[model samples]
Target: MFWFVDGEKSEYSGGRTAVEIKSWCTEMTGPAVKEISSRKLAEEQAGTKPICVYEGPEASTDFEEIAARKRTEFTFYHVAVDTEKPTVSVQHKSEEPVACDDLTFDGLKKCLDDNTLPLFGVLDGETYEKYMTSGKGLVWACLEMESSDDLEKVADEYRPLIKEVAEEFKDQFAFLYIDTIQFKRFLEGVLGVTELPTLAVNKKAGDKLKYLYTGEMTAPKVDEFLKNVLDGSIEPTLKSEPVPSSQDEPIHVVVGSTLVEDVFQPDKDVLFEVYAPWCGHCKRLAPEYEKVAKKVAEAGLDDMVVLSKMDGTANDSPVESISWEGFPSLFYVKAGETEPIKYDGPREAEGMWEWIEEHHSNSEGLKERVAAGKAVHEEEDSEADKGEEL
Candidate 1:
């Protein structure tokens, strides 16, 4: 049963004030508890709250029974309240109990909200958002949902397989079934699921990689697929645009297919930008970015340094560490380094040039190339000085 204690009151009834306790539960706490319960069970739309509030001396035995059941079996959320010690604890079936910070109404609500979801469930828009950001990998079974009967048949076929895998790998992944009709756009556009009754896994919080199962749908096959995904045996499917035929602009155009080839060259330091065409900020930065590119070219540093931009909306970076929260996000990658350092300074051309110069001077590859007489920047500067002297 859900627990909600009024923060204003200091003490709880211990069989002496049963009448007062019942009145408080019915009138004051009823509405708020019902609201929290309803929101949590919105997927079922079960209006009634499945809670039984107990008070006084006999409650101790009930709490013990609930705790024992939680350790031995798979059950829903069970909350234990110690009014005298004035502590709150929440526990789900067979899982460790978490102590709530306070006895306030909001505290109880948060505890239940965080632990109420089952290990295996249907994926709706709301639950999908929750699970994707939960820092866990997701395993999805795409089922045809054109008709109620079809949905039921497909669900029945895949439910056992999903449940089995969920039990075995609950720590690593969240198992869910999604309606093909409901998430058609996502399936086709992101995961490239053309057929129904397909299995897919997204390593969202880890490598941000995705994999699809190709063979028959069975518990063992699905288990093997998940194992391979964890062990990195399978290649990930990437969302990439076609590589451009030519890059003649000062800012070399980068696509996902050519990310490693162009930006991650071991002998060249790179200033990379991820921008969306529709973004006003990106549009505003275009001229200044071109100016920076031109400065690099004129200085004869084009071979040692590259100015590149990628349309973040159309392509995904093959480098898993590369990501952007907004358009026109900039990063600097030194030669022979895969890690990208974020550029968060000013947006003007002069400021960008300063940042580039600072990193370039510190580049080990540039030093090595200059020592080997492969880089001409030093020679260009010396010749310019001589010309000035003459």
Candidate 2:
């Protein structure tokens, strides 16, 4: 029977009911029974759509509201308090887990190219696209520590637990690993992961739903946490807070870490700058960046193309997510793509403006901007030539 304890500590409530929900769940799904505390926690697990039992004191009324809000996707069993043999009304629903495999980023791409499905394993930078863009799923990604002994120790400790849990629930989840030394940019720069040997899950619904494991690193603790995750007992911690919205500036100031949603999801063509405030180069380019923003706005491509900046040096702004080679580095994001397109062009206002026009999807508007810009340049040239002739 499933126990629904009220306090933080989990405790069993009463005896087995006439129709036990846990037994029924085990029988139907083969050992997938989980004990949960509240309806709110259950709803968080709705993504995975597990069989959730709410036996809290308020189980009677709570499950009904949750089932309705969840749109009848998950199977719910509510335990009764009044009777020794509590009757459970099972609401059945069909659900499937997101399929993933263990491969490096490039290997993942090759699998995609070859149209093959992979079993979960350690991943590299190239394979980031496979998991991040899938739109929904769980990726239990771990950052490997450096020292050989420490690395071996973590491997020795986690390998068994990962192997055991992943084998049991392989169909329902994807497990991935990364060497912090190799794919330094992928996690630290892209995901804002500061803690070494950290495990984070991408819920894939939104950036807000991506959570990192902040608990102790023991195998049992980790196992419990993963179980909690699988059973929907935990909510995802945000990778970065919501980038505050404002309409005041021509350049969209990326005040926080909503890069995946604000930049990637909508898939607007973007010329984004990652800069350190202390860097002289970033300071020098700041004025020109704003000018480029204004020039793009003037061309009426602000909606289609965005010019934005993030302070890579800020405490909240993860240096990992920005992962720049220098103080100020620019990346262009194309519409409908998850991977960033690196910008190697000149950083001047006119040069940046021309690049935006070159990539802009509005062909006619691009032509108009090009012609107008050329006309002004030609006029300046003609005047200069006249003065030289005189």
**TM-score of every candidate relative to the true structure:** 0.65, 0.39
lDDT value for candidate 1? 0.64
Residue-wise C-alpha lDDT for candidate 1, range 1-390, written one tens digit per residue: 223332222223223377866764454332322122321332232211122222222234434333322211112232233346544344332223455563444554555445444455567744555566666788777876776446546776666667677778877887776777867887776666777767778876434457877688788988888899889888776667888888788899999888888877788789999999899999999999999899777666788888999998777776777877678888888888888888887798999877776688356655464455545667888999999999
Tens digits of per-residue lDDT for model 2 on 1-390? 232223222122223674564554344443223445543454455432334444433343434443333222234544434444322222112222222142333432332322211334445443455545444455555656665335435555566556555555555556666666666765665555777668776544224245578577665776777777777788555344445656588877674456555556363687788787689988899898899888767756666688887775542332234445466878887777666777878778888777776765565666686588779889999999999999
> In angstroms, what RMSD does candidate 2 have relative to the true structure?
18.8
Q: In model 1, which regions exceed 4 Å deviation?
A: 1-115, 125-130, 133-135, 147-154, 187-195, 204-207, 361-390
- Kindly give the stretch of ten consecutive residues in candidate 1 with the minimal lDDT sum: 46-55
lDDT of each: 0.64, 0.55
